[model samples]
Target: MDWITHDEDVWFDFRGSSPEQLTPGRFYKGTVDGFADFGVFVDLAPGVTGLLHRSELDRRLESLDWESGDTVFVQVKNVRSNGNIDLGWSIRQSESEFRGAHVHDPDGDEDGERIEADDGGPEPVRKTPKGISTESRATNGTESGDELSADATAEQKRVEAEHDETRESEAETVEPAETVSAEPDVVEATTSDESAGVEQSAESHEAEGTPERAAAEDADEGTEAEETAERTEGPAAEPERVTVESLGDRTGDRVRIEGEVVGARQTGGPTIFEVRDETAVVDCAAFVEAGVRAYPEIGEGDVVRLDGEVELRRGELQIETEELTELVDEAADAVEQRLVDALSAKARPETVEPLADHDAVAAVTEQITDAAEAIRAAVLQSRPIVVRHAATADGYVAGAAIERAVLPLIRDEHSRADAEYHFFTRRPLDDPVYGMDAATNDVTRMLQDNERHDEKLPLVVLVGVGGTTDSLDGLGLLGVYDASRVVVDADAVDTEVVEEASVLVSPSLTDTGAADLSTGALGANLAAAVNADVTDDLSHLPAVSYWEDTPEAYRDIAGGVGYDERRTRELREAIALEAYYQSYQDKRELITDLLFEDGGGLAGHVSQQFRKKLDDEVATAKANVEARTVDDVDVAVLDADSYSHRFDFPPTSLLADTLSRRDDSAVTVVYATDELFVRTDADIDVRAVAGAASEAVPEGGVTAVGVRQNRIEFLSGARETVVDAVVDAVVAQI
Candidate 1:
């Protein structure tokens, strides 16, 4: 038996665990998805996939109609991690077939698909009865095929099928109800037609692929469960077998933990990385005994299922590995993970290595980590993580914890979720999905540092409390935004999808002179302040309207730095364009990849959706201004993702001062990002100019022309008309 150490143990001192001798194939046992049809996918061990084909689903199932969601019962087959093994097994087969014989009649070898080839070829496929096959034999060779006991297998499969049919006929007397609530409920008792009709009101369960038999079983005349048993299995002296059920809620002997992966932590010793699944992170030590690298690879966002004893390790409840594996068979999850992974790589290519393309949760964790840090710093400094909230005064907000503590005076979470701000964090990060110690700590630090000095730091925390859930603390960081941040805490709300962590500024500076707010300086400021450089002439910003437009009006409201509307619009457009490109590019890639699955060459469904969306964008570019810009740049309506920026330094300047990042004396930014930018007087057109752009292009098939009201459209083939209409509308606005 594999024994897991308690939390207090040194072994538990590690953030994760190493593979032990006991936690392998036989160690993992799970109830097969009893209702599974076609195939049953299982994890015989961590990061392993085993498939039980429909042919082995049941003796009766092969010839019957099977639907997609039908679940079944399964267990680990022989496991050789280094070598692949057919991972599925079944019961309910003929005795001969179960003994490793072909289920097809030798005389009927008309197709030879089920035959042991005369020449060296695959062994005739055989079925099993005990739901387990302990033998190991080559699946190929004529020598292998000549050694056969399978004539019985073929006869048995046919017998099992016929017997099942007979039993099903008798079972009609029994009332049809929900597909077996569980495998265990199919009892040995027989039910007859009278009792079923009189009491239970037997409803017909249309078994898949089953045809109506003209003569009903005579045994079904009376109501009895044993009668149904006879109907299903024929005249069996043995009782019907009971299968284990999946009681969704675990009040029994086990606990089911489920969640997304957010972050990874490492102890001082091990080289293995932690696999942070959402339910809770677990210790996955690499395996070295098999002469293979243990902890070979582990990345964030891997979906996992673990059945282990709930042990308290260092005050944390973690499972001590009875069973665990990455869930990779589901198509939707796999696709989502691939997109997020690609995005994360593009966003932060340096700090982390690429995790598997299938771990979506892991990539999102990385994103949360990045976004949270930016917001944390902005809030810690005097910058507000601004956004457009309908009823708030500031028009932006902070983490929930900050909001609750500061809202008594500030009164809003405005548009924080969508604003530009810097975020900061402590090293070796730790917290729940929303993060820990720091969500509130940054604000606390600001207050304390200010209090110790009493003149500079004014603690103004902003939060979003209206979006509360059962798991949320009234004023925690998670309450402000649902987007998860990278942290280890399970109690906090930061690991979900609706909110994010950020800091809100009340814009309290009353200075009537000086440049006021430093553009793109909040993150560096906090970093500097924490490092004891608080006197950097960092001007505080004045409040401005969420919908305010134009540099002059912005300046009038700000009173110090002129509102950089051109810059902000430019930035906004860039951000939109970048986001749009990401969306569409991923669509193109996914579609392109679909042509490869099982030799498919067709575009994927996502690609179809993206193309359709682009076609629509071409048709309605002008009126739908926000949707028109990829972020801000308008390109050929059909290929907005292919649009390149033309504004040069122009669009780069339309951002809020708080959004740009400062190194020392200079601020730097990518033009097509951030929906707002700082407009330094520049000659470049903020949007694309068709006359100039077309002339600039070397003679091409179709040239992209101009920008209108921040919308960019292009000239092309059939796509040109749509682009023309959209660009024409926007150009009229400009």
Candidate 2:
């Protein structure tokens, strides 16, 4: 057998090139091919395989949880002439646990072999195959044979014999000295073991990679020629292929990406397409010409290949597209399948057990899951979450719960400290039913943000509101721009509203008259599902929403978590006062502190003010409220224009609430000379009341308005007649 010696530098340069060239004393990331009685078979690469013997393992072989396709780290021990590979054990079971662990490939990227050893010193000597030994001088002036193992010598001789036969067979074509251009400095070793013991056949693998690599090289050469003709510098080296999420490290570097177009829009100078691969979504901008479409045919859900440079624009990562092409046939199907596999890993939660104690909540658990997914997806896509809720204590608590959960996620996912303020916003509405006025304000602000700052359209979330068909016009307006909407409410939602919203969480949709559940309860559970980290912080909000007669389950849950009935009431009172003061402002930080922070000082002080103002309003309303029995139904009617505060702190609706609570009336309706607002526990259609009043008093100018708000209007001259007619009409309906 022929023996050859190489310097340490030459050995360091060699790595896994071919089956016979697989070097020992090197580390590799391999795939578990199969398990045998003696050891596990590891496939290092297409033509390189090794056996990880059971005896070398630190633990019992049976204890390993590795499956066939699982990735592992192994050290090459020896290579036998029969093409049998021996692998040593590794203390590290995961790739992340090791430093400088790389894909050991001799013909891979140029920088692939530059991995640094942990100790900055020479590694222990390992036996090499025959004609590939490294001779090192003994520092102690003595030679020792301990470095060579018995099996290694025998294996080396067998490899030499196999090599001699291979050389004889290829004598007709191979020269005495042959080299591989891909690895120019490396020596080529001929082996006759066509049916090698590797996990994959070498002949078949070479057949597969040959044509693809040839075509790629030709295309690259053509591109280089074109680039050389145009400029001194040849074509920029083909960009590295990467997923969208990996773009963070590749900023300012060119990259090639493939993904489906989840969203697309036109700006003044560029066309932006939101490309979402399985990993993440990134916006790609293509500027073909000013105000001109870059790719006129590409639309949402179409798979496309993109070549671009990653750039940070306004604190967000975007791709500057240089080349774009739509994928078709097999390529399209493959891309689609990859996305489906990723989406499958994000399946809907199996159950909402802890949050679904009540039957009503249990019924709408599926809808709750959908809502949570939408909220989380918005955060992931870097879209701001805009919350709209009524300016009521209950509405405020619900909105605050979502805010608490979302702000933490924004902070954790984004680097900027002010991302919370920029990405999450809560706005108070005048009342339930996201009306035209509130929607118009949102649309105007979002459009301004998108135009001035190039911001993506915000995800509009409606809490304690937007559950009825009365809000359709406003929702449809948002839908026109393709802005996603998620509605969470405890009110009885109409069927059409449920269908229109991207996600609707309302127990009443499952069963009629199941509207006793509070919005805070629904939002709290949803908040927990949206970000599990904030679940404990939001558990008490549901109890705090109930002014009185809180559910036993929710009350216990709150008390067990430290918020008692008194504390809950204090929070409710504080939110109510805060909700009324500006009526328009959301008061995000103040509400967050009063609910989540220690010390009851803020809540106690606010509750005292709440009590005094509410008491004074109730006493005056009770003294002036005119009560009379009409057709066996006790009716309490108040002329709000004459006695109660209309434009002051206590709104007409709150006044009506106080009047109904103080009096023993079965029905209470408050109105001005022209407007009517009704609040009652009895089953009555206030819209029907307005209609009947218009028919009964035809001469009086009467109109039914704000069905969701239970409001109606009439002429001033017919005030007394209209009030009497409304009382008669309501009494008859009841």
Candidate 3:
């Protein structure tokens, strides 16, 4: 039999027996047995080997700094019917990284104690009824499969009795073991002999406490506990098993919970263990002499039984653990199965066909599936989800759609009234790129939460925004701390952005154009996949995104739900106004009231304001435009710095959009002192125009500022020259 050693206290025999001990979704430490073109083979145990596929590697497979015979960490992703195992690459590569790591071998004789095979050497000292026996079992050492002589069997029984005693003391309810009286005081005599070898005799302990006296006292406590369990084994009733969800009702009451240990972190006082049952997840805090590891053997992914009193700690529900037992056999098997089944049900949605009605949506079916799974996993893991979207009508509608879908599920899953607020947050971005400003804010908040509250980092989701390479640095900052990311966009983006995100939903990857598809429509479909119950409510959102060129299919969907053109426009207007007022906020409740609530007349009132404000600004802007034909193109140029109301109601972006829609111009350019906004029927790279203008009129100090809005900033003194140069550049490009 071959064995592997983990430090001085742990040894695992790789000579495999039962395959049942190896379960999927569990992390394992294995040696890199071999490698192939497709993947690497890892020997979890001797017979229990798994393949780490190349596709699962975080980096290129060739870049892996691992060699055969080196120890590595891998996750069991799947166990095939043919008895083969599929492994996923783990970011953590060491034992200390995981909460609990153990060699799960059911065949071990003494409850899987870390033991090594005997080599040719002197037999170790053995304990007996009368004294310490320096016995050599060399004659019978060659026997296999944990074979024990008469003396070895007695020692094994003594060790088992000690364990039973430890368990009884921990549980604190079982009766004393009767074996303490039935069996002679062999443990005491053995300790006495060992101490006598040091010349610390019984007489030496009469005046003062000797080492033998202290040892005797410790043995007495074990003797008392062993006697308790032995006497109470049959009559004690099993504690009632409870789920984490039921813990709310069981506050101030003692209950037993069975769950998988998903996370474990140590605080100054208590070791907090995040345990998740099928119903929900909760933290269980165990304090053992402050700053000590409460249960060192229990690691993440281990199924165990915990007895504790539910209590409110710092306004949060936490379990005060009394007795935690790492389970085996039927109890462990049952818990593991329940967790796996629940995760499977939550991770995959039933259908994505409703979202795939459009060609663009259909093309990114795989991406949609991945995004849905990542969102569901985040919910299941109880990680907070942060959704960032552009501060446009389309982006607002899209962000709200996801909010509508996820909020209900959070409310249903968690017992706390404030769970929705804590678990989900949406932020509006003025720019499409998740740039430095946004990343700095997120990192600051996340790091503070992690340090002050022991909270897990959030899953940052980008809708309508983070699909461009410009957002790479922000995403990279989040990744530095192992935060997950998902991007859902109806815009063409670079491949690097797709690869940087954990999950990306974009049609461009499938060679489909997303120009016609509204971000609201894409988000609605994703929201449906995330929580199908909200599908009907979100059906009208796609139609609301488009002020012009509204898709017939989406309009029909809105119409079917009794949201006529008038109601749709009203909702859209209301959201746009709210978005302007709270450009940085998600405005979750306010938007929810406008979109999903009944005839409260809220949207109508807001929409009226939206119309009045916009109509006034558009009216003023149209009158001030210097309309002209620049090579047969109807160009409307407004000196936004003078005529346009810069600090008032309708923003320049909205004003520009409204003016462009009217017959004022084929292209609209609103110019402020240092900034310019461009809106046109055809797509134009405002950045390119700025570059050309800067090169053509060097002193203009022109540069593209907002990529998403197609805006540029230039020197006010060189305004005319910069404007002429930009107009010429645009004419040449078009």
Q: Which has the greatest TM-score? A: 3
Candidate 3: RMSD to truth: 23.2
Task: Report the Cα lDDT for residue 470, model 2.
Answer: 72
The alpha-carbon root-mean-square deviation between model 2 and the true structure, to one decimal in Å, is: 20.0
Residues 90-206 of candidate 3: C-alpha lDDT, one tens digit per residue: 876654554433555566654445433223211221322111111312234443314434554454346446434531111112221121111111111122321221100010001
- Tens-place lDDT digits, model 2, residues 1-734: 42332321222323454556666776666666444323455667643556675556674443455655566667777766646566788766543344443334556675344444444222222332111112211123333434444444353345335434542110011111121112112112222332111111111111011122222223234343445655876545556557665666666787777778866765323467878776667777664322245678887768988777776543456776766778889878978887766654443444454443666777777888888777876776568899998888889888998898889877765655688999899999876778788889989999998877667799999997798777888899899889999999887677888667988888876763455578888788878777777788988888988866677888988888889889999999888888888889978778878999947999999989988888887787778888889877788888888886777757787777767777889888888758777767777787778788888888788776556557777888888888888888778877
Instruction: Quantify all predictions' global Cα lDDT against the true fold.
Output: 0.27, 0.67, 0.68
Q: Tell how far residue 417 is off in model 2, in angstroms.
A: 2.5
TM-score of each: 0.21, 0.61, 0.62
Error of 2 at 726 (Å): 2.1
| Candidate 1 residue lDDT tens string, 255-341 | 333223322333211112233321113332221111122222433555543333333322222333223344456632743464345
Best candidate, lDDT: 3
List where candidate 2 sits over 4 angstroms from the true fold. Answer: 1-241, 244-255, 260-276, 281-351, 354-356, 699-709, 715-717
- Give the lDDT of residue 407 in candidate 2: 90
Ranking by lDDT: 3, 2, 1
The residue-level lDDT of candidate 2 at 321 comes to 70
